[model samples]
Target: MNLSLCMIVKNEAATLHKCLSSVANVVDEMVILDTGSSDRTPEIAKSYGAKVHHFRWNNNFSTARNEALKYVKGNWVLVLDADETLTPEIVPQIYSVIQREEYLLINLLRQEVGAEQSPYSLVSRLFRRHPEIQFSRPYHALIDDSVATILAKEPKWQIGYLQGVAILHKGYQKSAIAQGNKYAKAQAAMEQFLAAHPYDAYVCSKLGALYVTTGKINEGIELLKRGVRTSEENYEILYELHYHLGIAYSRLQNPKQASLHYQAAIKLPIYPILKLGAYNNIGNLLKEAGDLKTARKAYEAALKIDDNFAAGHYNLGMTLKAMGLFTDAIACYQKAIKLNPRYAEAYQNLGVVQLKVGNHQASLIAFKNAIALHQEQNPEEAQRLRQGLQEMGLL
Candidate 1:
């Protein structure tokens, strides 16, 4: 089957080449829709022999996506954003799955690069090139609605997902959001769409989470609760709704409600990899409540799903340390540092644990590494650590 890589980009010259390079050998063709790029994004696309089409920016993702779809000549289409790339491990799986006739759409699991908590999510990036398949929603443009319509008309077509992570997306990282006014852009687009689609589960989930993060806890809670009450049983949406509700309640200092929402989120039958955040958050709540044993179990469950999750390892370490298991805490902290070398908090805690165990040399080294990392990521943390160490005659 001929596979086409379809994408909508604007001023993405910095990342377009890397994104395209990852899939160029795997995809039969590349179709890039440039949304008025001032940079060399179009030139970069053409360098890879990609058919580049210009679309005037209208702040509507679905329209741009549909325009890009019009040019896909292959039997299957793989959608990706500029900040995302196909993993080398998934290329063989993609080739294998696209040849199967029973699958109409395949949701690829994506690893959120640099995200500590919920490191994995499923995205409908790969699908058959059906004429009826058009993206919907203005912000998080999705073809799920169109795909659902097609499936209802043709019941034989089945939606399936890859078991392993197929893509790595950096767009959801805090650094990305902090740059490019991305948070503002996302909020404006979703808010506009939510005005019309007041009951849309996807938008409500996305916007509610945004609101909670932006300190509009009450607004976010209202929308998320509305989403749960009105939206159909989309497990992914439901999981996000409850997860964000947990966050909102946690921010409001209501651990009882937070734990309840987190537990509800975890009970959803979505992929365990996608529920890492819920597990981690619930563990944090449990830890704060002095339920160290339960918190340890929660972190263990998260680690069971994704052993490479550094945050899970770090949280487990914290719980172990709180339970006076210093040796195990040190091991868990070391594992977290191995998985994510820049994990400053892990280093900081490791230092504390090492100091507790009378390993003065190791503790000093850990503190130095933690201080260096915190200097770049959190200056206030670095300052506090310096002051504490100085008071203790260690710095």
Candidate 2:
């Protein structure tokens, strides 16, 4: 089956090349629809031998995505964003799935690069080229709603998901978020959709989560509670609803409520990789509540899901340190630092642990590394560390 890479972009020149290059071998053609770009995004798209088209910006992601889909001339369509790339490891799996006759759509697991809270997400980005399968919603647009309708009418069509990570997405990174007033744009787009779909669980999960992260706690809580009541057995939606609620309640200083929500999210029948956030958060709650043993178990569960999770390693190190297991704590902290070299907190904790174990030289080096990393990110903390070093006569 021929696969077409379909994308809607604007001013995405900085990341477009990488995105196109990642799928160059797997896709037969690239179709890019630019929605009013002021940058050289179209030029970059064309450089990759993509058929680039232009569309007016209407502040609706679904409309733009639908327009892009119209240009696909392949048996299958693989949708991606400018900052997202197909993982080379999953290319063969994607090819295998697309050749299957029963599949109407395939959901791909995406790893959110640089995200500490929720590192994985499921995206319904691969599908057969059918006229009836169009996207919906103004933001976070997807064809899932239409897929549901089609599957109901045509029982022969089946939807499936790849269990392993298929895409590496960098759009959620802090640098990307700061560039385009992205928070404002997402809020405006999602809020527009919410006006028409006030009770939509998808919208509730999305916009409510946004509101919670952006300081509108009460509004987000109200919306997410509504989502929990109205969601139609969508484990994905339910998981997100509870996950964001946990964050919201944690911010409100209600650890009991937060733990409950996080556990609820973890208990849902979702992929284990997707449950990392809830596991980490509940572990944090347990640690703060003086339940170090239970917290260690929670962190261990997260690490079992993805051993490379730096936060899990660092948190596990903390739990171990509190339990007076200095040797094990040092190993966990070192593992975390190895995974993320610039992890300032991990370095700081490693310094403290090294000092506890009487490794004076290593302790000083770790403290210096931590201070240097914190200099720009947290100057006040850096100054405090400097003072501690001076008092210890190690400066």
Can you write out model 2's per-residue Cα lDDT over 1-395, one digit (the tens) per residue?
99999999999988998999999888999999999999999998998889999999888899999999999999999999999999898988998999899999999999999885898999999999999999999889999999999999999999899868899999888888889788899999988888988899999999999899899999999999999999979999999999999999999999999989999999999888999999999999999999999999999999999998999999999999999999999999999999999999999999999999999999999999999999977999999999988998988
Q: Model 2, which residues run further than 4 Å from truth?
A: none
- Per-residue C-alpha lDDT of model 1 across residues 1-395, encoded as one tens digit per residue: 99999999999988988999999899999999999999999999999999999989898999999999999999999999999999999888889999999999999999998974578889999999998999998888999999999999999999999878899999878878787787788899999988988888888899998899889999999999999987678999999999999999999999999999999999999888899999999999999999999999999999998899999999999999999999999999999999999999999999999999999999999999999999999999999999999999998
- TM-score for each of the candidates: 0.98, 0.98
TM-score, cand. 2 vs. native: 0.98
Score residue 23 of candidate 1 by CA lDDT. Answer: 90
Report how far residue 94 has shifted in candidate 2, in Å: 0.6
